[model samples]
Target: MKRYLLAGLMAVATSAIAAPPQPLASADVKALVAPPAKGIKVLALWSLDCAYCEENLTALRAYQRQHPDVELIYVATDPAYQRDALEARLKRAGVDDVTSRAYADATPDRLNFMIDPSWGGETPRTLVIHADGSRKAVSGALTPARVADLL
Candidate 1:
């Protein structure tokens, strides 16, 4: 009986873990920037090597909580094989609830261009798309005022 109980508990715990992020190819980048039908949407692009990504993600998560009408999408510039590490880092930053994606294309430069032509491949970049089809892109770690202004 004790062994059976432990096995069941382990199974439940494993099942509760969040799934790995989906692949975000160049073809799918447009969908990330599409205007929401009614509410605002924020797309955050970050990478594992970026020093400020965690801080930005934590702040964004808090902002989303305060403004529930805003939708948050998280994309890791890392490859799909690193999904485990990406998910773990995002979980630590308290951004596990939103849709998450990872770069899966052979040509990351092309994918980056699709995400933003003028971006210059920077980490901790944010793109805020409004329902009216206006977009604002910001690079570097986001400050409270900066995030507010972008939204």
Candidate 2:
């Protein structure tokens, strides 16, 4: 009975540690880009399979450590069902503590269209939303210098 109890407790603890990613809707993405109460907002869109996405995330994580005042939002382009992988990637990137969202819609094209009509569904997309709500969107990985400039 003690062994069973320990196994159950272990399962519960593992589940808590592997919490699923939050579902991201079109409106959610829009809200992220909205004018913030203070400091600049950085929206980073990435996927688990993209190599450049990992590089961008690493750069962003370092930038976040330096500029904690900046609001960092990480949007995972992978489908919501792959939350486990997405969560693992975020943890590896050192951004597991930040606000994170995953693509909820099964049809990614619709979600892509909703996020940005001109996005072309690229990974490692970065958007710098200024305090005034004006945004600059860049598709592809961002270098450390560019990340610093964005902040």
On TM-score, the leading prediction is 1
lDDT of each: 0.86, 0.80
Worst 10 residues of 1 by lDDT: 12-21
Clash pairs detected, candidate 1: none
Model 1 lDDT tens row, 2-120: 99999999888765655568999887888877899988998889999999988888788788889999998888999988988998887787677667899999999998888888889
Which ranges of candidate 2 are over 4 A from the true structure? 1-20
Worst 10 residues of 2 by lDDT: 12-21
- TM match of model 2 to true structure: 0.80
Please write out the lDDT profile of model 2 over residues 1-151, one tens digit for every residue: 9999999999887666544579987767677567787788887889887879978877887898888778877888898788889988878776676677898876888877777667888898887777876777888878999888766
After TM-score superposition, what is the CA distance of residue 27 in candidate 1 from its true location, in Å? 2.2
lDDT of 2 at 141: 73
